[model samples]
Target: MTLPLIHTPYAQVRQALLDHTEIALLDVREEDPFAQAHPLFAANLPLGRIELDAWQRIPRLDTVVVVYDNGEGLAERAVRKLQSLGYQRVSLLAGGLQGWRDAGGELFRDVNVPSKAFGELVEAQRHTPSLPAEEVLALQQQQADVVVLDARRFDEYQTMSIPGAISVPGAELVLRARTLAPDPRTRIIVNCAGRTRSIIGTQSLVNAGLPNPVSALRNGTIGWTLAGQALDHGADRRAGEVTPAQRAQAAQDARAVAQRAGVRHASLADLERFAAERGRTTYRFDVRSPEEFAAGHLPGFRSAPGGQLVQETDVSAPVRGARIVLVDDDGARAHMTASWLTQMGWEVWVLDGVDRSAFTDTGPAPATLPRPSRPVDWIAPATLAEQLANEAPGQTAVINLTTSANHVKRHIPGAWFVLRTDLERALSTIPSAKRYVLTCGSSLLAQYAVEEVAQATGARVLVLEGGNQAWADAGLPTAEGEQRLASPRTDRYRRPYEGTDNPREAMQGYLDWEFGLVAQLARDGTHGFQVL
Candidate 1:
């Protein structure tokens, strides 16, 4: 029997990436090659891993795997192994990374945070000198013609920056810098939290082959902090302004950038119209931190970090060819994200004014059908307790999904405190349940556990609301026995920078990028920032 194959062109690969479609971009090159630079969506499983453990990473036998490498040697081997593993459809990217690059396809740097990558572009270029706090003070005394461009986000700039520095985020610098420093030699200086963005910003101008000599504020605000320099937290201080004409121009520029990257922006009315009448599935993602999401989000919008949304659009949306609309306050986060999504191939839109109004739950109701279950599950304490007390005349079982600390303090009788992380491999221990209740800290995890188990064995499963806390809060009885076993140690809670090599490396890069944030905030003033 012949295996399914799809040999796609560089343009098609780029389009698949922009659409956020379910196309696995597997780079067969070794880790080091990938770290230097590769397609943004590409994951380096390496040729060895695929030959040995392709099934582990590429678990779904039916995933559309598109293999590529710098050249072609390893990819052919990968396709054979993938085919052996029952991956029904597998194909090679026609020209691989070289082809994409040769076609003038843009490549993404290994920037950790999606937002931070945007922050990297907001400063000037130069071979200018860095002034220590004392030197800057001295320069002030000397009445130097230097202007401090605070290359940080607006909010951070508002909190504190160099007293006289103006704001310009890294991504917007090229578009806004000329007006801010129209003169050829303005003695421009850039500063961020620690350094990366400031250095990158200054260097970007130099690389742009700009004539002005720019310099980064050495060590940025952190150096200021280390220098014991005082910060100005005064209210009513104005940041740089974005005129209406400038706003219009910026929107146009952003649109063009999006086009280059394949991102789309949609109005609220357009989104509403799509949602109101949809033959195709449409996912409304709130691309913000969980803290921001918990603070408030648009109704019916699921909280998916921008990178995660782009990376796991298949799992998040599941429905192929769904329309994706992302909500964020400004164009930086949305446009930058939209750029990646556009390359993926989904009908994508970035909605403005997401944070302007409170979320009104007036949209169509969620599908009432039960979600497909998985092999493992977690449940709440209250629901678990109820299920335990009223089980059938068989050996019913229950597992506690709480921390060791909480389990030691209190747990339901006869319930084993299994770490929710172990639920997958530990499923073998689950006795043929008259039923099993998976209890956890909250209903959220428990609900997921129930779904997982249901998918695996069609087990009768239930999750408790409020989890163990709810049970304890209800004055439920406790068993004070020492735990005979330890919970499984899982890194599920740690969200790593999902880029090149290990997550730690990605996170470190992200941190380095974030360190330069305070400076970017100051350079790009916050006039047009809408929190929604």
Candidate 2:
């Protein structure tokens, strides 16, 4: 039976934000759909991976939580799941997403709408100088002492970039810009896949008082592509580390910006107290590059590069209204990143005087602590092979719960790909069998559905021990491609920026979607932004 959903109207939700009340606005859908349309503050907590991330993302169990969906009936399901996880205060956004529209609420498009809108607003207010794609292309053609820098992730820069552009990511610009082009005459042009990062990055240099002539590539690579320009693929150019003097300048500039934004500097003792406080969630992030973080870093701090942290705050700190403390070996990155958080209406803090020698880790701490153990019946590969060889030929059924993409790649012979949600209806269609064996990539996912299957169909539902990996390791041959699918392939959505087979239409569609977010924010009017 579906559990009854507690509903909160858009008016009360909007009022909470206005009154500075603490609440988490969640969008429980896949990343792609969540990117297409969501509120400025709604965090995307996909239902498929909710079990893995919910605890770390939503640390305080008693915190007020509100979840919404695009009428997919996912909100109700998510509410029940959160309740099952011991969340005391949980409610669904009444009437799904449509209800928000009916109540005159604003709907935004694209992931990180808040950051993107902030960048756009910064440009509107500051009039941060920028040159259109046409002019930048001319400069590149002329080789007029211009150094192009991509402010997006390195992989994104490698995927598609302006010819001769170097990867300098967002926060790195302030620290490493001088060394890359020490000659003050060398004009600096910053770009990203789209407008936000480029705008934010260009403004960062301008705000830092860089001596070089700085300007954003108008609208970034999207505008470049739209202007019928070529993007270099598989480019490997990158920037080097900061010099001692450059580092000092970066630290001084960043601290000033953070102070101007009212971002407090917290000591180790202050952070300790914040962590120990009951009914409060505190996120400690090391705002440095992955390589720097990998060498050694703080014990509790996670590696979130300063640039990406500002761009994807929801992924970093899902608990809205929670205290955030950023750490970095170089004072620049953390303070610079925290400045953005402050303007974005977050209660952000920067750690001061931490010993760099104390840090000694490679990655962030696990999102959840000590996961609950759930037992799944063992189905060894050799035993399953013997069962498959039975004379009846249909006595035992093998169901794979891996992604459709993975199932299409390789799967056990005669295994039917199925979705956990559609397993009941799917079981009815499979040939009459004495037992049903469920497997995913590792059977971890299948284990969650095993008990439900037995309760519904009264069949002996056994989980494949070690799943397909064990089968392959046991020298069992597997099949390739989609042969049998018990459910439709609706579990995953294709990203426009993913893979190389693009028809140009999809890329343009993505840009068009981003172009509209500014207007959406205007209509929504609930975002409490104080641009610094």
Candidate 3:
């Protein structure tokens, strides 16, 4: 007997989008491949990570989820995985990516096309003001009243930024703009690595009804670099705190904007009702600074800085179309963050009117992870240390499945570093041993590989009790070098746009790719984007 076929055609998907119906148009490929070519609204949920990240990325079991790959045969496999996981409305893109091409749809390169393209659209439609990078530099050199704000994350800002730019991040722009530039006559300039966040950040201030004149640094740091300008590194300047009066005023202003975007506030009772809906996936995020969240945050909430949350929705809340509730110590941050999220096509709500005592968690929130169903043996750290110290060579083999960079930095002595995906084939080449141990920075990844390793090699497989960290804590020495690798490093891909060593052409190529996203989004026509 053959299994039934499920297909979602391009036209059907397009119609649903045009009609404003909800759908999770997913592309099941790795981040690197997914960056090469995909539709504007297609969220990448790689096949290798389906079991790991699927539940958190797609919340509703019955929601229409159309997954495709570029004829890589991953979509069908993903469909099976989703079905096994009890998803009811999973379907394959009719002809995979070829179907979209056949239907004359545009394929964009790089990630976050929706948000980036939306920025371009907003700039085009609203005519957000801007200055060339050179002009902005000159203004800074002249000690003009213009204040530059970096809209990227704090780390990214610290890496490289326009001269004298303070790190304000995307979602913080509206909340902190008034405090940063209280004078109505002060000019504000917003920027990011390239164009998206700069455009969005500048427009956010405009939308918030800031009295000062606002403009984006055209093309952002890319333009600054192209014009032979210098970028500051390791800059630690950040926006200062907002007072009680400022918080109240910002809350009122942000709440009005959220209302305009149809984002409602959720009371404690409303969130309780949401939590009760077990089948529906709901993500509750504390959208505050990492330091603030670590001091204490509401229970059952993950820490996602509001600005980074807007910049990387796929990373933060991968569950496309899931209901998101944002929490902030002050009401303004959540409301402002929710406003952008609402515009980005998310059903978002801000928690309001909660007492200060309601927030109650220490350290980071626990991760959302899935465990494999397998019977696995564990060797305690002390036992492993003793075995390493006393056992003869070739008696037991320890394989580290952590990242290559991390492995190079330090790993358990005599342990071989291998990629988890390549463990089976690589195992055959290694010297035979009576026992095998799998470990990572944590034991979670190692547990998923125990069954596979055991089945492939017919060996007694055991997991390190608490991974490599335990061995180190037990005073077991570690090794450092690339010579201990048992498999070729294929797990992590290096981004071309990162770091200071990138060639001029690669940087130029990245900008060219982003500048074309707006055109591709127009041709795709599946993205239901609205700019305010």
Per-candidate TM-scores read 0.42, 0.88, 0.88
Q: Scored by Cα lDDT, where does model 3 land?
A: 0.80
Q: How close is candidate 2 to the true structure, as a TM-score?
A: 0.88
Backbone clashes per model, in order? 48, 1, 1
Segments in model 3 whose C-alpha atoms lie over 4 Å from true places: 1-7, 19-22, 71-77, 276-281, 381-396, 413-433, 471-493
lDDT for 352 in candidate 2 is: 91
Candidate 3 TM-score to native: 0.88
Model 1 per-residue lDDT tens digits across residues 197-250 = 565455434433345557778767665655667656532333355566654554
Colliding pairs, model 2: 297-359
- Selected candidate, larger TM-score, 1 vs 2: 2
Taking the tens digit of each residue's C-alpha lDDT, what string does model 2 give over 113-187?
A: 778887887887789899999999999888799999999988888888888899998988888888888998999
> Candidate 2: where is the Cα deviation over 4 Å?
1-5, 369-374, 379-446, 462-506
- Candidate 2: deviation at residue 161, Å? 2.4
RMSD, model 3, all Cα superposed?
Answer: 3.1
Quality of model 1 by C-alpha lDDT: 0.57
